[model samples]
Target: MFDVCIIGGGIAGLMLAHCLPSSLSIAVLTKEDSFSSNTALAQGGIAASIGPGDHPTSHATDTLFASAGHADAERVKLLTTEGLAIIESLLSRGLPFDANQAGLPLLGREAAHSTKRILHAGGDQTGKMFLQYFLAVTDDHVKRLPYNSVLELVLRDGQCVGVCVEDGQGNRSIIQDHHIVLATGGIGQLYSQTSNSSVATGDGLSLAFHAGAVLEDLEFVQFHPTVLTLNGKSHGLISEAVRGEGAWLVNADGQRIMTGVHPLMELAPRDIVARAIEWHWQQKGPVFLDARKIQQFKSKFPSIFTNCHNLHINPGQDLIPVRPGAHFHMGGVQTDEWGATTVPRLYAIGEVASTGVHGANRLASNSLLEGLVFAKRLASKLLSIGFNFKEKEIHLAEVTKEFALPANLQVRMTKLVGILREVDKLQKFNTDFPLRWFDLQHYSSLHIKDIHRYTACSLIAKAALLRDESRGAHYRRDTPETSEQWTGKTVELSLAGYTFGERLLKYKESMS
Candidate 1:
């Protein structure tokens, strides 16, 4: 038995492995090759309060503002305050953050932030740099099981003892461990047009939900404002950092977008910007990014420059056609400050865990910071509370229900539950899905992946249907205003059903 089995090879899981005690046997598992994650594709820099003339209070305030009334003030404050260490740690690890001649990291301004507090490495490849640095350091020590998909979390008595993994060759096996950390990335792959990597299929979210963990705010899906449109589908992301460098949004009719959407205009938070772009696209035609005015844009944003060059669009002259696409989920398996879930010995970090840092919507570039900080916190917490495993007997349960996931399942979800949602469509899907899904589950070709898709989609639909107000990333055309009653609240999904729960209840209370 391994000491810990980490079910992701992304930044969060790998970072945790580096912090783990040397005596412990660590196994890092992933369905794809190691380093395939949202982290690899995250072009925008990570946000921290470690720049010139910046304070944690100011950063925290901006996070709260971007959250649109759903962020936990105390948690945001903590995240920003603790973010100082994240930058420091990166620097200590020899991360080559872009710096000025004075030897200070050059900070860029992002949406909702009052100060220039975003740090980039190798220009716009901040997340990729972080992943490369950490993965290199951690892989040497940890046992990595690449291309093994975790199908189920094995439960005995009340604690999560291990996971059931399906190999690439269609073989299955069980690996028992004392602790399990799910750093599995976002749920963006649930939609057709998304910024997430194909590997991000909500495996962690669905598995945790089925294993009786509390999942909160699955409805708050963040649609990024400016994804590159390749033949009407989202081919890639145009990092928000580009807008930070003075690019503006405009429509087909040469109308500037975000003029009246908010005071910050083009620099408005992702949710506001995405809503504006989507609304304009629905009403008018395609929206484009006007980066012509920015000085030396290609050198500064080489990645986006290459992307635009390949697409035959010149940022210097031509308007880059952009659209809203599924980018991030602000909610998932709810975890407390220590990254512990409602279930025993099961912890979730990264995008899979709703740690109350990003409530209704994530602040710009905070995703990487959240995952890094929480991964270290989880490792520390586990070390403090040493493992005491009284291994219980686990049985391989028989699979009765069997059905193949329909090819059109993703298409239906993308249509009905895309960026903009409404009660009429949500209600219809909620009512019709269960009966149809029930039949699909009992078919001969039912697979574990199909169950995961059904579970993730169902939970998101249920949560979105219950929340009748428009807030942050979860916008509803029917109720276009944020609700005051749902302030500082989170809708939790459990095996029993969905209901309201206080955010970050005591650790003992969570298991109760």
Candidate 2:
């Protein structure tokens, strides 16, 4: 037994371990190599308000505006307010943010921000740097387990006691703890094309959902406007900061794609920009980002430059082919200010939890900050409760239920659930997916990763179908306009089906 078991050894897990008292026994579990979490792969930067001409109030405003009325006002305030202190903490731990000649942190603007406040270290290595810093701090004390993916959450009555995990060698084990924190990243890999790494298969979301945690806003999948598209699929991401540096999205005919779409044009919120690019990509064949105007283009974004160079395309001369690809999840298991879910002893942080700070759309570069801020909040909350390594008596027996997803559903999901969604497709896919999931469940050849991917995809599809209005990252052609009724409300998903507003209230009462 342990005091805490943290799934996903990313920045959130590492930082949470760092904040917890060293006397407590914490186990950090990873699905792959310890560094495979999206934290290390993040290329943009962490968003905060320490730069000149910026404040958390304005930061909060931009975030809420981008969320399109789904972000929790209180949580948004907390996330923005706590950002500066956490950045300072990370700085004290040796995260070297790139600074200007005046010795102030150099801040770069992204899509929805009101000002240039996204901070990077070593140019595009902000996430990588922070990951290394936290890993170094937590490596000695925390038991880091890689290649062990959590298959199920161990819940008895209402509290989560532990997790059932299977390693790459097919060895299965049960890990018992008083608390479990899920920091597993986004569900980007559910799509054939995405900016996220392979490990981002929504394992945490599935784990939480199967264990009876409420999932909110699962439809709000953020497709970034500018990802390098190679051979009809997504490649490396071209950070929104590239456009903030004055890059323009152009088509094959050299026509700017987003000229009249929004006031901010290329620097508009990712949802607007991604839709415009996708619309143009379909109408005019392909889209590209022309970065010739940005002075010191290679130096300002060396990572993007290197990726382009590797593909034999120079931003100064050639138009890099770009397309919208799944980049971030603005929804997951619902959590509160302390990152505690509706379920007891099971907390979620990072992209895996819907703290409702992102609403329908996530503001650019806010993801890294969300993980850092929420993990700190959770750590503080857990510390206040005190820690003890006593095993709780769990009398529950394993029960197998029907898995409701199709065998080849991942391909179907990628086809139907892209930037533009339709109710017919969503409904049809939702109906057929579960039957397939059941079939695949009995196959001994099927891996645990595949099962989790199907489950997560099913939840996303259900949530997308449940919401009939277009807002933020969730755009449906049938429901092209946002409605006032859905504002400040969320889609609550479970095995009993989807619920909303009063229906959600009744559903919980029934569960009780």
Candidate 3:
């Protein structure tokens, strides 16, 4: 038995494993290879208060302003305040960062920030460089098990004990551990087009909900505005840093549409930009980003330049075909300041946990900062309160023998809750294709927990339907304007009453 079993070997899990004391046995379970994570695919840099003119307060204010009054003030403050230290720690561990000739940290700008506070390494390849450094330092105390998918979360007497994971060859076994951490990232792959990796199938969110953990902000899915439309699907992300580097958004008609759309124009927040692009796409056939002005900076951003070259669309000459795609989740498993969920011995970090830092929308590079800060905080908290394990005889829950989704149901879900949403369409979806009682019954069983994937998707649809007003990434075509009171979070729980012990209370709670 180990002290901690971290599901999803992303930056958060790897960083937590590296930060914790060596005496504590930690096992990191990755569904595939270690590099298969949204963290590894992050093209932009991690935001930190590292610039000469930058400070935690300024960073915090910018984040809150970007979040548009939905952010938890205290949590946002804490994340920004602790971000500098985390950056320093990563630097000390040999994570290479870009620097000027004078040896000062080179800061890159991104949307929704008043200052140039993004600290990057190797241009747009910061994520790869950081992952490499993390892998290089991992010791024997940190056991990384790749090709392992967690089938079910093992709970005993309403407390999380371990997980039942499936191996590469489909062999299933229980990993009995005292503590469990879910850093399984976002639920983007559920859509037809998204920036998330294939493994990001809302596995962690669905697993946690089934195991009786509260999920928050299921409605606030952030869609990046500028993903390159490749082969009828948006795949490659045109980094927000491009806009920071003086790129412009232009429609197929060769008009810079953003000038009259929003006050901030290209520098506007992501939600505005995404909606603008969507509106443009609806009006015109296609949308594109004009990067011709910044051709001279191609050498500085070689990764982006090279990626565009691979697509046979040079940023200097061609108009980069772009569209909005699901990028981040502001809502996730509800957690306290210490990253502790409703469950007693369980915790969540990174994209999976709704730590209230991201609020209605996440600032461009705050994701990486949130991961680093919270990982350290969770490690410290876990180390302070040491845990002990007791091996006791327990019976496994009966596993269901079969599971499948009707093809029609999949099509309906994708249509109603895809990119755009409307009340009439949602009502039609629920009325026409209601989730069968048998599906819900099978989903509750240990062997059939994967069936809960549909349940999770249904929850998002239902929650999106309930939320009438357009705010942040959750836009409603029917309700075009933003509502004043409906400007906060939409929370969903597996069981009710604010505590994990209150298992029967799983319901929806919205706070403004």
Candidate 4:
């Protein structure tokens, strides 16, 4: 039993733990070590309006623009405004953010940002630095459980009370808690090529859904415009900050790919740039990121430099192979300003929660900021509410099959549900695979994780099929234009089904 059970060990879970009072017992459960998360893999730094000539409003405006006007105005304002304080607070705590020679924090711009407002540490190692910092400062009293996967949320009386967790050796147990927070990160591993870690298999989404929590915007999967590709496989992410430093996207024939694609060209919103590169790659063959012109490339992005070096490709001399791949999720378990989900005593933050700040597309580098701001908010709310013990009747489902992930799941998802979408493909995907939030009694913990991935992929496909118009990261080739009808509204999915405005539809498989 615990006072607070946070399901994830990333920055958001750790940040929440840090903010909570030591008087309360807190346990953070993770499938892997703390560093194995999308947060740790983040190459671009956190975004804040702290640079010269930048303001929170400007930051919010850029974020809204990147979101294609689908973002919540109030939440975005809060995210950007509070972001500055958090960065400053980290600095005051002696976080050695990369700085200019004069000791001012070095700020760099990314695609869609109006100004240079990104702060990094150790060049491209900003996320790593943050992970270390949060892990170090987190109170020792807070328990950290690695290699523990949450199989299901235990709900009673319409409120979440605990969770069914599985350990590394396949041991299972129930954790009774006053509060349960799902900070389990994104669903990128559902795709064949992604920048997310192996643990990002949509565990939080499925758990929340089964527990009757609402999920929003599952279709808005952001594909980073530049992930290093070699021999048709993703090597690693090439941060957009490279373009912010004057890198260019070129074709196999050495022609500039983004010259007339958008006014911002290589520095345009990720959705625009990714589509452009994909189109060019299809029409003119492979595409590459030309960073030869950037001075001190190795010093500015050591991680990327080392990756390229390992591949024997010199960014300063060669055209680095590049392609778009799954990068960030713009949606997940829906939450309010306080990170409280629709379910009582259950919360979500970080990439797992759809706070509606990211909207249809996430602004580059705002991800880290979202994790920090919302985790703090949720923590404060939890501290104020304090703890109350509750015991619910325990129920265990009968075990059946031990299924593994399908061999072709990733390929099918990448082809049908990825980058570009249309009605025909989406319908085909649904017809072939379908949505099945399998009966717990029919599946064991050993195979529940695999089932979750399939269900998550189906849910994403369903959401993509429902939203007919192209907007932000969700681009439908058939209905290529954005629709005013869908703007500012969300696609809310639950156990009963989902709604996009007045149309409420139920998944046929879910009913069974």
Candidate 5:
């Protein structure tokens, strides 16, 4: 038995380990190595109001504006306000944020940001730097179980008591712990073309759903505009900071794609930019990032420079091939201010938990900040509520069928539920690719993974089908305009089905 069992090794989980005192025994588990997470691939850096002339209020305003009025105002305020202190604390603990010659933190601007307040380290390797820092500083005694996949959340009497995990060599074991934290990252891998890490298969989201936790805004999937395209698939991500430095999106005729689209043009929120790129792709041929204007791209963005080098595309001359791809999920398991979910003792942080900071769309660079800030808050909350375990008999749900997820699920999801969404397509997807809670309770790890993928895709489709309006990342072509009635309303899903707002009513009844 352990005091806390964190089912991830990303920034949130590792940061929590760093924050917790050494007195408590903790276990951090991940399906792969500790560094293989969305945190390790992030390039745009963490957002905070630490730059000169930048304020938390301004940051909060930009965040809310980008969220399309769907974000919780109080929670957004907390994220921005508390985020500053967290960033500062990281700096105090020897985080080497990039600095100017004057020894001030060098701030970079990203899409939808009012000013330059994004902090990076090791050039474009902000997430990698953060992961290294967290790993180095995390408590030495914290047990790390890499290559251990969490198959199911063991529940007893409506409360999560433990987990059933599978090791790399097909070995399975049940571990009972007092508190469970899911920092299992995003649901990007559900789409065929995505910029997320391989482990982002919605494991945490599916686990929460089957364990009776509420999931909100499943439709709000953020498709980043500037993913590097290779052989008609998403190969890698080109950081938003590259465009922040004046790279323009151009079409076959060398015309600027984002011209007059929005006042910010290429710097508009991710959803708008991605839509613009996709529109260009449909009307014209291939789209490219014209980065010929940016000075010294090699030194400033070393990773991007290397990627371009490997592709044999010179940043100074050639147009870098690009397109929009699944990047982030604004919606996730619903959590309170203290990172506590509806299910008792099952806390969540990072991209897995919807703390309402991102609302309908997440502002670029806020992801890392949200993870750190919420992890800190959760640590404080956990410390206050000391550890005590009352042993309960774990009841594993009966498996109904050994479901093998369809291979074409990713391609189908991308087609029906990608950048553009509509009622007919969503309904078709729901009908053809149905997912039941019963199929999720399986003994095989591979089967469980497949169930998670299908369940997560189903959740997103159902939520998107229900919300008949264009807002933030969820743009329904049929309902191109944002509706006033849909204001403050969110589509929430669980094991029973889906519904809207503060109601346990059936989805059909809520829609009516």
Candidate 6:
């Protein structure tokens, strides 16, 4: 038995472990190598008020504006206020941020921000640098169980007791603990194309929902505007910072089209940019980013330049093919300011927890900042609660039995609720492959537990269908206009007490 069992090994989980008291026994269960995560693949920098002419208030304003009316004011204030200190704490722990010639902090600009306040490292590889420092500093107090995938959350008397994880050899074991934190990343892999890593299968959110935690904002997925479209799959992401550096969004005829759409043009917020690109795609054939005209474009964005070269497409001479891809999820397992869910003895942080900071759409580069700030908050909360490592009697067979999701359901989920969602396709998806409410009673294998992907996808589809207007990433081609009242969040759950639409209305009313 350990004091805390973290279900993921991403930056949030790692930073949480790093911030905790060394006396506590913390065990981290990672599905793959600790280094492999969406955090590690993050090319853009962390948004914070670290440079001159930048302040958390401006950052807060940018975040709130980008969220499109669904952002939690209190949470946004807290996160933005704590942003600088979070960066300082990471830096003190040996994480390096690139500095300018005047010995001041260097900053980069993304699409939504009013100021260039994003702190980066080694140019575009900020996430990689952050992870490298985190892994290096983590001491023996933190135990890593790599290749262990959490199969179920162990619950006793309506409280989270621990987690049951499966090893590489297919052996399952329960690590009973007084507290558990689920930091598993986003669910982008559920879509046909995304910028998220393969491990981002919505495991943490799915486990939390199945374990009776309320999930919010499942419908508010963020579709990034500039993913490199290649060989029937959109893989590479041309960072929003490209526009910040003067790159223009152009169409098939090499025409600058965004000027006719939004006044901000390429510098408009992510949702606007993505929708504009999608609309342009419908009007023309393909949308691309013209980076050739910018001086030192290839030198400044070396990573993107090299990646484009690998694909045999030179951004300096040719237009880089781009499309909208599922990039981030603003909605997740609902959490308070301290990253505590409604469930006692359970906590969530990073992208897994919907802390109300990123409501409908996440501001560019704010995700990394959110993870850093909230992980620290959660660590402080856990430390205050004190650690308890005494082993408790648990009904292993029964606990494991209650968790189940079928395999076929997973494939069906990916098909139905992917990047481009529509009402007819969603209804057909539900009719063809209904959610397995009955099969959840028995002890399920990994293949079976994966069907929660269907549960999650179904929720996203239903919520998307329910919202009659397009707002942020929850776009409906049928109802293409953004409505005044539709600016709030859309929530869904598997529990019978609340219908999906009712839950959304309740959340909206609560916010009001």
Every model's Cα RMSD, please?
A: 4.2, 5.1, 5.1, 5.6, 4.9, 4.2
Candidate 3 structure quality by residue, lDDT tens digits, 1-512: 78999998888888889888888899999989999999889877899988877788788888887775567777887788788878877777567898889766689877778889998887777877778888898888999999998877777788888887778887667788878999999877766557888777777877787677877767778888888887657656887778888888987777887988888888787777887887777677688889888957578677777778888988888888888777888878888888898887889999989887876678889988888888889998898878776855654445445656545544465467755778898777656544332322223343344455565576567567767877667778899777865655454545542211111111112211
lDDT of candidate 5 at residue 52, scale 0 to 100: 75
> What's the lDDT for residue 77 in model 5?
77
Clashes of each: 2, 5, 5, 0, 0, 5
> Please, what is the TM-score per model?
0.90, 0.89, 0.88, 0.92, 0.92, 0.87
Whole-model lDDT values for every prediction: 0.81, 0.80, 0.76, 0.85, 0.86, 0.77
Candidate 4 accuracy as TM-score: 0.92
How big is the RMSD of model 5?
Answer: 4.9
TM-score of model 3 vs. true structure: 0.88
Off by over 4 Å in 3: 243-260, 263-268, 282-284, 290-301, 394-399, 406-415, 429-452, 487-490, 496-512
Against the true structure, whose lDDT is highest? Answer: 5
How far off is residue 301 in model 1, in Å?
2.9
Q: Which pairs, if any, clash in model 1?
A: 402-443, 403-446
Off by over 4 Å in 4: 101-103, 244-248, 253-268, 282-284, 291-300, 393-395, 401-404, 501-512
* Clash list (residue pairs), candidate 4: none
Better of 3 and 4 by TM-score: 4
lDDT of 1 by residue, 187-284 (tens): 88887778889887888887898788989989999888789886677768887778888888998776787887899998776777887887787788
Task: Give the distance in Å from residue 250's predicted Cα in candidate 2 to where it truly belongs.
Answer: 4.0
Candidate 3 positional error at 204, Å: 0.7
Estimate, for each residue in 247-355, the C-alpha lDDT of model 6 and write its tens digit. Answer: 8888778889798788999988676787788767756778889988878877788888888999998877999888777789888888888989878888999898888
Error of 4 at 493 (Å): 0.9
